[model samples]
Target chain A: MHDQPSLAELLQAVKHFIDETASPNLSGHPAFHARVASNVLATALRDLEVRTANESAEAASLKTLLAVSDGRSLDDMNRELCKRIQSGDLTATSHGLIAHLKATTIAQVKTDQPRYSGLKTAES
Target chain B: MQDFEAAAHRLFSKVFGAEADLSDINRLSGGASQETWALSGGHFEAILRRAPGGVRPTRPSAAIGLATEAALIRIAGKESLPVAKILHVLTPKDELGEGFVMSRVHGETIARPILRDETFAAARLKLPGECGAALAGIHKIATNTLPDLPSSNGSDQIAQYEDIYRGFDIPHPVFELALTWLKANQPAPIDPVLVHGDFRLGNLIVDEQGLAAILDWELAHLGDPREDLAWICVNSWRFGVTENRVGGFGQLEPMLQAYADAGGAVFSTQEIDWWEMLGTLKWGVMCMIMYEAFRSGADPSVERAAIGRRVSETEIDLINLLEAANA
Candidate 1:
């Protein structure tokens, strides 16, 4: 593997610099952009921590929901799920549809924005 | 930049007087094509909103032109609705561009301070009702007397946003589900009125007393008035205070009551709920549009890039709304 600092650590360092140093020192649009940059880094770090497990879970859910045995990529499975929903084959009342959507969406929000109020509402 | 300042100076001199001295001219936050500027001259304080580069190119294809926006503001002001008074609509002779100067309304437009700060504790209680009444006033403006504007009902909007979403060609299962729900539950048509297409926290100016003014009429159009009511209640505009649904300040019932008190058409909770779900989906699609713009390098700012990730937040919200509806 690479040297001491992991990918998450490197991202955290950049985020720290932006939040603690760069953002505080700037003003106006630059300052706002600095904060956004820090947020981007934080999101990156979160995604790095959870991406593998989340993607596998999402893939398995999609496979079962779509009832496919072949090894389709996650993107292909997701596109198929969307097509089925769009075509009226899958619906809110359809078996396992809402469950799959909820699980997938919650997993995404966990990485995208764990603190979003919708997560709390969805979990409840 | 010097030329712009000189032109603005001349425009102010013509309007305020030959002796009018322009100072503190600062460009405020706005889109790339649109510009909002704050300026003052002695006792004269006003805001300048314009399409920079001296041409009106209707960028989004939804905006009623600057002149029409000014007219709407003037008409709204005449109806005693809280809005900035339009002072002057620019002429070709003014040479500054297509825009208008208006008496600045002093208030906070930022969401956090208005939602959470102790300074606005009193205003928060009154704001939801005030917003309801203001929206009632907007919807009541006789559409026949207004300038030609686009109009759309529920299905029309669904088609419009769906078309745009499809254009992106990215399959969002949640968005597809929302589309299905929206189509299956289209609200019955009503006589279309002047709908302030974007009536939310950021577009409202809240002062110590309450809502001082409604700004940003670029998205103004003719549609169902419930669209305005539900737009405010959308969770995205709640700014984290999701419990109080009406713009994160108060509950929905009081706001609906205030709207009725001010002569707006009474609406059922179920009716408004439909529109709220639609509003959430619309914002999600809008986030996708912003992400596309960023990805295409049209406006490659960190802000635009970050907004792309916010689509998941909308997904979670849609899931909650759907679950609640199903329950």
Candidate 2:
């Protein structure tokens, strides 16, 4: 069973939510943010006894990497992580996958544009 | 009504089999969590709601596995204000993920329709009064009617808004301002009425016969009846047709008159005006969730990312509205 997705998929989720939700004023280069995200998750994984390096060989068994990544705002951390990935800072390799996995799965992907709620209501 | 021609017909046809027909499936696009499609089929032409963005497993858990739409439809049906009759709720093991089937009711819900469409022009005049009474009916219903709602919700406006705010981790200055306004303009402590959280001209569906039904009660709560009254008149719902102050689709005079006639006492203009400020403030706060969602990448969709822009758009207007209301 697929527990999580590829790094590409994870990167896409981060890009999507950041583009859709993050404030226009989210300062700094996304690369730095992504590194911060990866490091945060990496540190958490180490503490949780998840995995060591991103060799892909040992990555698959490290399910607990993102497990310890709690209390932190999921979106904020993920956005910072993805920005770094896109900037080519952190690679979405094994061991580092939790940072990539969580970079997606943000909340409230909606719009107020008429297209979303169309000017029309339901039939009475 | 646009044809979601991609996978819709295929999905519905497969699920409904003999009972399905492909017709106009317009998008209702009001939800960040769900997407409601307005469609027509064989004997049934109605809405088809599905989870937004990603696909997940099928299980019955709040905001998790299943669509929980059947639950929404069931609750809406019990409220019985005029939602489309639920014909069937489904978690199609295949296409369109999870959703439900229902009978389409006929009516125009666009806020301006009540003012522009000859069909609803007359009916719009009567809604305010009927809206008041109907809101009362919803509030008076025993809490047991909805076992699913967290029991901690207080039976009042501030409590409900507080719950919604706390549920979403974001701050809204306008909400704080509105909260202040409502506190200052408290209306003599009348009995709480059911506040149709999303009630307005656009949220209302008008039938050919007129004054059809209320729609989208996802944000419904018990609160000051005037909140509903103020909500119906919020300028946002005016839909640019400000001439008809009642949602910009009908005049306030007649609507207020009808409410008064129906035993709804006259809420002071200034007091109700404060509620109007609250309306804008609450909406602005709610809009912040969209921004937070996009930033977090929880549900990544182009549409949601675009929605983040509206927070600023609404905040500016809400600020002005609050200033004017206070003045």
Candidate 3:
């Protein structure tokens, strides 16, 4: 809150350094790892940008799907959703289940790998 | 490093004779479980696959050991399948640790180039048939002659991956849904055959003629042949060219036709869809496992940490597959 550069800005600067400066100077495995590091930073930046909204949306959908109250944390609700799915209480054809899974997973892929081909496939 | 090179040289000299001078010994990268070294000697080129420092680390239960890998390659070669010929299996006397030397088969193993590069256009056309034929030959190998290998049917694999997922102690509703679907739709057990558990693009060497060699026998096991077929069609292996379902180069129809023509069991697309879904779930769980390894400091690398994020890709893939199935 007291800094010139925000967290996202700092992450972007480091990612640019890796992609534009550090990576080109490396070769072979080191080069590959530099690219991966850049990707990791990029993913972090994306997650930071979207995490709050995505989490709240995911939690809201999970509450609807699980018919739970608002007091539970997202982690707690997700664990309940997982238990229901695993225990056969919820299923592929369960009401609002596929929609919830699709929405949640797509949001996650948007942050984790926005360019992943599966994202297009999932959305379409 | 010098000691490793000297030992390797001596081993090569002993195997290929003193006249076969060894040079250009370089450790090829990737693969955390095993080390692959590319070496040239006189007119011959070979690869050394070994465990580091003569000590074999405990690998996952799925992996067949290096010696067994060599044995499978030898058997596959005898079956006239394209494989790197096992030049020598190391012994304690060799003092270079557990490994085998194989005559290298040259080709591109990277997926993107094989999928998009014009250099592989002709290879791409012929690959599905060739891959089918290669798998046919592998599946036909008499199991009695094979070294003792673990075997699993569809349910076994589901249980295995589910156990692994449980071990990670992370909750992903998508994974839970996938597990539920996989269990409900488990295919009936079939007569086990030699299944190349990792038969995707990166494990194959494709030149202009297509599929010069099939490498990485560490995951070789006795299981359903459909496991091999479906594995190649997994979205993860397709790179980005998702239209070409069979390793991002060919359609499923030609591959299945070639499989039958080559004396492998005939399979319909519907029959293998279950396996494809299972393969997707397995990869998603594997990504989680990689992340856990990184978190536990077992193998702290950016690559391992990055793979954890890829689980979402698989999750989305599962949703798509499930939606398609439901449709």
Candidate 4:
């Protein structure tokens, strides 16, 4: 929908999200790093939503934004989320919850997500 | 006595009172997240947990904070778990970084001792299933009750997996493979539960009383309970006790059955199997990150680097399991 925001600008946007949306009384340390995480997720969710809606500018851009990662996916996010959770910017549950909401929305539109049957998780 | 003496004094004075006399301060080894000092305040016993860098360090993302763990300690105590009791959360005024002072408990928490302790080996045998049941207890912690806690549902965990891979800049072929399999073999979504994300042996504290405490809630979050089921059962956590299967304590079926008995809904072998594979991928990437962290000096611990090396073997284990399951 728009040019990808610069990392700094995105960071500011992340701060805005926490100030506006996240829980309060989070243990505060690792401010910049947490900012980056908030920034990345904020941008990722926005981009993912647009892409799922078929509004992403292009495919390559989507990949770049999502940063199809290697090894530990949460190493980066968790580091940030841990700080965020401690900071009260987000909660232990909120990160997963928000990601779930966004990812599910994408799945709903793309219908590309896996659908397992008779699995234990399914029974629940 | 180390630098922590004065620092502990400052923190204790800040939290308890000026009367607190901290003595016998010794730096305990093996905590990546915080500076853990086993110290006593003369009349009272306590452990001083402080921020590692002695500053409010920011993560790669600038908007986050580092001192939140101290609070989580208090939160865990409120849940009636056997975690250390939080006495005070203090800002490191002159020397110590922001940290919480907690009442320390006694137990052997190291993996090697737990595995090798003759006196405790029998107790160790009972741990895997116990660990699973403990996880179920942790999951029972309701999100709505924890003020300022983030909200999560079942699938939020996948994003957690994805975030680690994204951090690496190189999507691990192994992780990608596992992700592909996990996606392909996705289990039906279930009601979310609080997951002790690192429900492994080393993360647990045990005594003759059995399953006395669980540590390292730094990774705890809301997610699929089966993910916790799969985490403890992962091969790496077993430390070659894969023969034991239930996190180096017993077999998967018994562990799952024990978990089922503990009030968890019975999950199919296939679903637990998927989470197991995903657990391998998760741990593999986690170990690599540790290796990289050691190399980068962001955190330097020889054990962590060793753990990194140990994790690769799990990759081979993963392939075998996946093939066997598919077979």
User: Which structure among the candidates has the greatest DockQ?
Assistant: 3
In candidate 3, which residue pairs clash? Answer: none
**Docking model 3 quality class:** high
State the C-alpha lDDT per candidate: 0.88, 0.52, 0.88, 0.58
From the highest DockQ down, the ranking of the candidates is 3, 1, 2, 4
Query: Clash number for model 3?
Result: 0
**TM-score of chain A as modeled in candidate 2:** 0.23
**Per-residue accuracy of model 2 over A5-94 as CA lDDT, tens digit each:** 754456656655555456343543343344334433333333233222222322232224434343454345434443444444433243
Worst 10 residues of 2 chain B by lDDT: B57-66
Question: Which digits, one per residue and each the tens of the lDDT, describe model 4 over residues B1-327?
Answer: 357566667766666577877666766655655566777766877777666746544333211133455555566678676687777766545466666667778887777677667878778767766866766567777666543444343355456656766676652333444455566567888876766667777777788766877766655555688888877777667765556666676677767777778777787777888888877776666667666777788765444444554443554555555445554
lDDT of 3 at B301: 88
Ranking by lDDT: 3, 1, 4, 2
TM-score of chain B of 1: 0.96
RMSD of each: 2.0, 16.5, 1.5, 16.3
For every model in order, the TM-score on chain A comes to: 0.94, 0.23, 0.95, 0.23
- Candidate that would win on TM-score: 3
Superior candidate under DockQ, 2 versus 4: 2
Give me the displacement of residue B129 in model 2, in angstroms. 4.1
lDDT computed for candidate 1 = 0.88
Cα displacement (Å) at residue B314, model 1: 1.3
Model 2 over residues B1-327: C-alpha lDDT tens digits? 123364677656765675687776666644446666776666656666665532452321123223343554456568665566665555444345666656666777655556677776567656655666565555556545543442211225455555666566554333444454456555566654545566776567776555666666545544566677777776667766644566765666665566665556665666667677666656655555555565677646554455454553344444445445533
lDDT of each residue in A1-124, candidate 1, tens digit only = 8856988888888888888888888876577678778888888998998899998998999999999986899999989998999899999999999999999899888888888888888888
